[model samples]
Target chain A: MKIHQLSVFLENKPGCLSAPCRALAEAGINIHTLSLADTKQFGILRLIVRDWQQAKTVLESHGNVVNVAEVLAIEVEDKPGGMASVLEGIERAGLNIEYMYAFTIRRGDRAILVFRFEDAEKAAQALSKAGINVIDSVALYDLVEKG
Target chain B: MKTEHCDVPFNNVSAPDFLAVAKLRELQLQRLQCIVDRAYNHVMHYRDAMEQLEVRPEDIRSLDDVRRLPFTDKTALRDNYPFGLFASPMNEVVRVHASSGTTGKPIVVAYTQADVDVWSSVMMRSFAACGVHAGDIVQNAYGYGLFTGGLGAHYGAEALGATVIPISGGNTERQIMVLRDFGVTVICCTPSYFLHIAEKAAEMGMPLQDLPLRAGVFGAEPWTENMRRRIQELTGVRAFDIYGLSEIVGPGVGIECDQQNGLHIFEDHFLMEIVNPDTGDPLPDGEEGELVLTTLSKMAMPMLRYRTHDITAIKTDPCPCGRTVRRIDRISRRSDDMLIIRGVNVFPSQIETALLAVEGTLPHYQIIVDRQQGLDGIEVQVEVTAELFSDTVKELEALKSRISHAIDSTIGLRVAVSLVQPRTITRSEGKAKRVIDRRTN
Candidate 1:
């Protein structure tokens, strides 16, 4: 199972982050999780929102260059070794994780870990075979909406 | 053939080219008086400037009296704009050419039929000086449109009875193919552009030295002796420097004889003077100063004591080629703030305009000019605002691209845009230092 993530290009400037966040909020699109990757000049804001299309539309209307990327979102136990166990399975399956971020669902005891892998489809199959509970876009949107 | 054997007096050398010192001075004095009288009678700008100096046309008796004339700079040209400076009426003006003005309005120059003939003859003399003959196939690579370089060289090559390919600048692969296929003998363009062609030829597995090209009449921008040697060594072409300005006459004011010593100023057509740039006082021979030119033969627009701002000394010593017209050393530097990047004149102010148009960029920026692979490279390092300093990599990259595109569209030159950290650029208290040029030889 794969999850759709919104990757936005942002100049490393003040109010650049808030502009998109405000736009998405005004559009009534809820962001489930966001992680920022930055260099001195610019940064990439990766986000998982409840409505990807609406979030992209609102951001694009604000003159932002937005793109969609497929990632693996899996549910893991909110325990110390939970992330380590999933990463070890990914490593064993020869899949490399580009970056990852996590957020806990208020309704469940488990944590939602979003991972961007070099090959998302291959990682999804390997994680599924490894007995990891991979959440698809529908389930991920539902979880985000429930919160 | 080797350059040493080809080094000889051009067949088109006129009587003025062989005038003795006394005769040359006498001719200059007579021509100076005629032009001064013409400018005073025709052009109001020159008349007012002369009247302000209280110097009448009759006052210019000797060549030394040229100092009494008011100095005309680029400001005068800008003030005159389109055709205000022309001495002749519109019907007499046969052609018009202009400098690429990235900062403001382009400097416009007009040529009458007589003026066109004079330009062609002078170009022919320049080509002949470089050992180009009637049978030689001249592949002109200088830009043709508004700039005087392309058509100027083309007319001259044709006047010399040489077969001109008339191929304008750029298109490196095609330039090489034409060079090989046509067996082009003489190449004409800026020294830097020629070097680029040589590099491209080498990349295409056809080094220029093996080509049939024999001579190159290179000008439009200042170049070095080392660059000449490198061009000759790589392309096996004897490179000669041809000097001219659109203000006086484009691409035919002076040319280097086969001696490759100094560019011989065409004393009969244009009166050349060396003057102190600051004081406007004349400097003697062998003393370096700003070059002032008065168009003696130009009919459309006769520029009187027009300051060239090119720093070089005149050589009175006789050249081995026997051309008695005095030679000015090859120009390597300019007294003005203009920077010639890839044959296009760029001012620091032009770069500022380009930067201010883009968002998220601070006013603080530095233009760095360097020579890489014998071609000019410009890098605009702009400071990002504190807010934008933390933007995503993709956003910053987009900003950089936008800036680069703006500058390219504005100036017609490609530049690498670098987004530096906020407050990283040094603040200057006095004059804001905008340019860092390391392309000097």
Candidate 2:
């Protein structure tokens, strides 16, 4: 129902985004997907890895402050209204989404969406009751490997 | 007949700046006794504090006995508010000046007619010490309102028999124009403001060095010796430091003699002492500590052992200027400006010094103090330099850790360091705001 995502604090500057990427690349950890949220002063780089625990330890060793967050990877149709249908259920279930991003690759006609809800447990229950398929960490890792 | 104490006799009748040391101490003791008696008899706050300490006016028999009295701090003034601390009635107070009170209500200080006369005389002496003699056209650039800097310098310059230009602060273009057109020989203002004026003068295509300005009396903010040298080099003027606060008697309490090594505190009017800031125990001469002052002759509102919060040390060696009055090291930091994080006293200047010592760092930084879970923490946000910034978090984090380590060694406490983009920190025209304390008391 949930997957581990690595959030690293970074100053918003010319070369900040390349830092953790180089760190992960040096550690031989492949980043599955990543997104950046920024203000004027700093940025938060949120990325998914096949082995987040190892990635976290490696990043920590390299002096990066890594925050691990549990996010749900939902499988949705890649067609129009696919995201809208999923968000409708989320709005109907009254679960608040703090932030959300998408995976570049698609599995068949479905796309994977990563969501950080304010309450992950309650969000899982709502999405489960809505009959939506939520991908777990093991299955997501397998899907990334197959892709 | 020439006096043994003064090589060049002062025309001012009240110039006791060159009095013999023995006679000076005797006068101080007498004035101290009188001021303490007046404060005890009139001001309820002083009387209450002295009573709590079991000290009476008579207990201050000698000059050394001032230590027995309680130390009055800024809070004492705030607690009293406007006129609560005034020893004289409203009729005798000819004028009143106040601090900017950036934190709270302005600290009000009153001066009687005699007090004003004394202020004028000391200011005149201050001008003389800085080589602003009569017939010198003085440009008083200190802000002239209730701030005490403007009017204080004004009265003193006039009393020195110099031509006074009542131009207050700001109006940089006009200030430079007057500096050129008026044949102004002396300029008085804050050191930072003078830097701005010099910059403006250069922009106007009239360099201050080319002007007739021969002397500058800069004060109202703590400035460094390096800044003084830069000002002298840029302006071609003998920059003198004038030190005082509104709580004492504006900018005439002390002035740098031609020696320029330290500022001489007029002991006949303001008795000076150096004491440990935390312990309140008096430190020996030549040791850096908090400067505590006692007004020996102020009648309107006599301050007894008032803590100035300015950090300086008394010079053990006599000044070559032949003034018997003692000199204090130039004040660059005030105890009031100190930030205590995790029980360690840290000054912004110390942080600045630490930041500049590192190999790849700019002087631009801000100290942010906050509290969480009942514990104090400090975060130093340093502007990222092109050399310090990198494409990898590893090197950037290394830079952060290096900065943190530098500050830790300088202030003796661990601090969290954050790197922000360049030019994000705000800069002010006047005194630069260096610290942002978010900790709620």
Candidate 3:
């Protein structure tokens, strides 16, 4: 139902984004999908990974703090109506979005919107009924490159 | 000139009982003027602060005129960097000491040759107040580098003409051997390190009480009367609290006399104020607030109304010793270090005191302040010795619970307790970083 997300809290500085990636490579955890929430002091580098438990262990072992939570990824069209419809379905479901960020899934025609919902289970059920191809764990694991 | 009393460390300025109380306001204004002059002329950060206060350096005359000057804080020191509040040229500085560079930035403070002498005199008085005299052989186990406590005590003992040993910190075995062989009379170090030495002495079958050491001076950290009682019982020495900072001339600005009444500030050399940290307005005596200082006799780096976030009170009750200098109660805690847990002030020092009382838990600790479910929670991870953890898991948890409960009772803040294996948190070579402030930088 959920993929492990490696959320790295980095003090907004140069080369801070690379440490988690480097640690992941060393520990051999593949990143499926990721989004970044940037702020003035620090940035949250959130990642959907194949093995969350292992990713958490690796990051903690490297002295990095990581928190695990479930996020929904809705694959939408690259067109203007694509994001608009997906957002409409999410808002229409009566699920509040604490934070939302989008990343390009493929060659720019399709975009993946990652969401943190208060009611993840209810939102997943509501979005799937709206004909939205919600990104499942199986689909996410397969998309991850075996670095 | 009363040159005989001039040599007295922490000399109390005696006035008639009624006069002392009446003159406190007069003294404050006189001191306040010193603060304004130092801020306006030397530190630009303070000068700008004074400008914002709609005050000028020339406007400050006597103590009543101090209202025109602005206050100071640690953040201002950080913003200025390196030499923001220094009152003299770098070449005039005889030495420089700094606080631990935790909490984003470290506070760097300088001392001139005269400031060093003033520090030693105050510290000498610190020792003498605790009955430290010339003939006593003093073993200064306090660390020597940077931070003021160790060397401040060291030079003061030397100035008092005591045979001094510069055995700078750690290697408990050597400290013990030196105590036995040298027959040292006075010991100086942080209160926690004193406990560490006492425990080691007991373990080694060494009778620490059998040593010639009669008294000790401890500071740079806070401790409780319970811990002090235990330390005194262990070492058979009367423990005294000596207070100062690198900004104000190191470890000997004020010290508790044999009476253990309060820290007698060298008010002539340094001015004292208890200010409302929020409003910057001065608070009257017995009013607990941030302690502010102004150095009247320093040249290297004169500080004016330097706000030392140490939370305590300035009490002028004439000591039985007959000194009129206002005595400061032992610092209960620091304002900046206060952990606002659910609108309650929870300080790590309070937690440290609790952990030290539990016997097995060492003084070294890291307090993790995290946000859970939109409410701030605390996780105190204390490292115990291998002996304490090997046999008893349940018992250790009980100790943790007991500590948490004690801290809850003391500070009105509840915290979750976690026990870790021996040597879990890295020991800092210099100032121990006992706190990991996850709440804010």
Clashes of each: 19, 1, 6
Please give, for residues B123-193, the per-residue lDDT of candidate 1 as tens digits.
88887776778888999999888789899999999988889998898888899999999988888988888
Off by over 4 Å in 3: A1-147, B1-35, B338-441
What is the Cα-based lDDT of residue B172 in candidate 3?
A: 81
Q: After superposition, how far is residue A58 of candidate 2 from its true place, in Å?
A: 7.9
Better of 1 and 3 by lDDT: 1
**lDDT, residue B248, candidate 2:** 89
Off by over 4 Å in 1: A1-147, B1-10, B13-15, B357-362, B386-402, B428-432
Model 2 sits at a Cα RMSD from the real structure of 11.2
lDDT of each: 0.82, 0.82, 0.70
DockQ of each: 0.11, 0.13, 0.02
Q: What interface root-mean-square deviation (Å) does model 3 yield?
A: 13.9
State the TM-score of the second chain for every model.
0.92, 0.76, 0.71
Write down the worst ten-residue block by lDDT for model 3 chain B: B1-10
Backbone clashes, candidate 1? 19
lDDT of 1 at A95: 85
Q: Please write out the lDDT profile of model 3 over residues B1-441, one tens digit for every residue.
A: 101112334423222212364475566556556646765788777777878988887787766455456656656666767876787788888788876322324568888787788777777767777777777788998777765767888888898888899998768889988987888778887776777777777888877777767778887666557767878777787889888777678877788877887888877677788888888788999899989887766766667678788889988577887666779899877777755453233556667766766664455578887654223578887654423332112344566678788766655557877654334477788556777755331
